[model samples]
Target: MSAKTKNKHDQSESPRLGASAFSARSKRVTVNMGDGQKVKTLTPKQRGATTEQKSVAKDVKKVMAKCKEEHDMRLDLSRCEVTELPRYIKELSHLEEMYLYGNRLTTLPPEISSLLNLKILALSENMLSSLPDEAESLLCLKVLDLRHNRLKEVPFVVYQLRSLQTLFLRFNRVTSLTPEIKNLTQLTTLSMRENKFKELPEEIGYLRCLSVLDVAHNHLEHLPHSIGNCNQLVTLDVQHNELVDLPETIGCLTCLKRLGIRYNRIREIPAELEKCSDLEEFNIEQNKLKTLPEGLLKRFKNCSSLQLARNQFEEFPSGPPAQFGPLTSFSIEHNKVTIVPFGVFSEAKKLTKVHLKDNLISSLPLDFGSWVQITELNLASNQISKLPDDIKHLTKLEVLILSNNVIKLLPKSIGGLCNLIHLDLEGNRLESLPAEIGYLTSLTKLSVQSNRLTVLPRGIGHLVNLKHFSAGENNLTQLPEEMGTLESLEELYLNDNPNLQMLPFELALCRKLALMSIEGCPLGRLPPQVVDGGPSAIIMYLRTQGPYRAMSFS
Candidate 1:
């Protein structure tokens, strides 16, 4: 065939999406080859991914071929676009592990049962809907992964594998677990996330060896009380479900350490949960919970993190006027919290992050900086009108967000935070900044847009590490000449300063500037060509022009 015709025929045989499933996993790098056609190449990382994929895919065929000459055999054929098992795999009677992930195979060949010694089988991410009866004959199999498949029911044959210890069936369409599951008493870990199940069989309690159970993102309306029989369970993740209440028996699992029940319709935290003395991480956020029982809060005081955002807790609920030991991160954003009582976290010395965005808080306590270990404090979209001067005490603060508030001034000590990296004070009524702001040498991004500022601190020049400066929609008519020393500034947003009439010539010294939004500024005397040239032209003018001439664009 001619070259054009040959290319056309080859394209017809290739998958419309890509060459194979292996190619789908690699990052694509397209290059212009001219004549409307482009060629794609793989990045170094993706090239390595292809090689690794092929190596694993070929292991299955190579091992089975050499099983007769070798004592031990194993195979992995994932991501090879396989639709069926190799006819010769039965020869590897000693195969211990078989991996066939990310393929088109819909059936587990009955012939595979011949490998009586198989200990693990991974058939995740495929089109398998049912298993053959022969699957039960593999009595020695200890681990099975059928995640992200088309299975619509629990494989009854899987229950026959009494030795199975770890079972993963996440992201399947299975609706419910049957009593047959109780037969697999050796299960230690079970994952069934993103499934259609509305209930788990009470027989699940029979798995006394179960240590972890993750059924998150399912339709489970309630958990069986028998689940408490799993005395060995340590971590239980059932978030994003319709569970309205706990089984009360949850407290019976005294060994549970991490319990995640967020994004549910639960109205109250069962008092029985206090019995789980081993709990460390409790994520009950985004639920319909309006009241936080004192018992639950007291028990969770030892929790390391609590995400209680987007809940119905009005009036700060009734929990803590006490310390939460080990509590490093606490978020209660988008609630009806109007006040953050003083010394709320006085005992929580390890606190690092606290997010209270979209609340009704109006003022901060003078000792707010007492949380010395705090690194991030987000109080955006609140009603605060002023800030306490002691805000400077938060020396370790790295991120401070106070946007959309009615504040008129910043504590002069605000610049003392040497570790501050990102500071946002947009939409406030600030008139000026303290010159002490220059003390923040670690600042990388600063936002002061929609404020009443007429001048910036001359000390702003000391921020040599700043990368972004948003000062748009302000009342500034002139900027400090020191702005030209910002060697690291890449974006300058000064779009709506309408009263500005002069453009500083020193701006051309900003070698790293890639974007400048200066449209709404009324620069009456500056050369029109300079403004029209965008950021690059402005730099070129500064490079060639000896001095910033009032009337010259050259």
Candidate 2:
């Protein structure tokens, strides 16, 4: 045949092979070249362009082949960028666990139900908006993690998964669950946090086996009364919601260990909650509560952590629980509390941390010395005028924040805080720091700025470990010569001290002092070394200008 007619004939006779045509047995096929000559040819290249989809298709085939040969029960295609699953996936009927998380898939295929033995399915962090109705056939599915998806509602097929023990739908768009959810008789965990749920269905009580139920960050207004039926619940967190009150039946959850209802509109806690004797952690802060339910504190025999901040209480919960337990941390800041009721904390000797800032209290009860185990005490922004001499009992305290108070003097006993590392007395009415302040050998930061101080105690030089010192905005005429002993000093701020006329030449001994601020001082003319240099240079000039005198602060 002529070349043109031969080419046309070959083109029209070219065999179009399907994907199956490339089987091992047909790797090579005989074809008529249409030129009166027969030629042997290998399998043709794949029909589509080489792209990510093509590679993924090959991966799916390989995985299926391997699983089919080994009869593997688990398959993980997580983060594989898979958008569409092949219908042949059903061939792996033995698969008991399947993870396709972090993929681009928007929907699952109905054929997925063919895996009747599947007990765990994780499709989290995907774009899935729905599951096929046929998924109800997965009767053995025990765990379903569909978090970080776009599902606007619970898939109806999910309720049919009678054996499901854990269902995580967090970070989804789901607004409500159907009453059919009660069908999950074996469900133990149900987390739907960060959704738009207004209220849970009353049928939720049917989940008697549920141990953890977290629906935080939703728009829930009230919990259904039937919730009390889940006596097995150990954790119930509804934080960041609009809940007006908890169901009185919550007291039925005797097994509850952690209950968080923060950031809600609840005005009063149900007295029935005191029945949860096993409760250990209770957080009800940022609410409209003015007083706790009577006998609430005494009932929490095992409670160790209590947070009652941002409330409207006028007095401390006095009459300390007659039989308090191992209370370790107590925070009641941003309240109207005036009387601290020292007797309340006297019973809890194991307390380690206390946050009583931003209150109206003018004085701390002398019983504060009883908390020997306390390590951090933040009593800032209160109306306190003087610290009890018993403050020396807090020898283990590491941080003491007493700023924005009207204290005129610090007790000499304050030096008893040997382990104190941070002491902030800023915005105080202090006229002077106690000479005993030098006893804090471990002190690293000390700020007495905006105070009524005339001079720093010579003992200040003993803070060998001090790295930052701020004594600005005071009536200081000069720094103590002992300050030169701060070998670890790195930053010093002495601005706005108008009466300050000169700095101690001993400051030159602070070899590590890199930053120094002495603005608003009326120091007269100085040599080049002192006028245009850092702390070290200025101190050096003073050392040469003034008579050298050896002094000992100790």
Q: Candidate 1: lDDT of 194?
A: 79
lDDT of 2 by residue, 1-554 (tens): 36586335323322221122111211334466888776746442332333445666687778777877999877777666677888999899899888776677899888998999998898877899999999989989998988779999999889888999988888789999999989997988888888999989999999999998989889999999999999999999899999998889999999999998999999989989988988898888999888887778888888898888987778766445453446898889999998887577767777888999999989988787877888999999999999988989999999999999999999999999999999999999998888999999899999999999999999999999999999999998888989988999999999889888677777766777778887776655555446567555665565555554343322
Error of 1 at 159 (Å): 1.9
How high is each candidate's TM-score? 0.86, 0.84
TM accuracy, model 2: 0.84
User: RMSD in angstroms, all models?
Assistant: 8.8, 14.0
The lDDT for every candidate, in the order shown, is 0.81, 0.83
Model 1 lDDT at residue 22: 33
Query: lDDT tens string, model 1, 1-554?
Result: 36586346323322122222232243455556778766767663455546544654575456456655675555666677666787676777888877777777889788888889988888877899999898887989987888768999988898889999888887789998889899999999888877899999999999999998989889989999999999899989999999999998898899988999999999888888888877888788889887776657666546888788988877554555553656888888988888887778887788899999988999987668787889999999999998787877889999999999999888888877889999999999999988988889899999999999988988998899999999999989888888888889999998899887765677766778888888788776667887677657656766567364453333
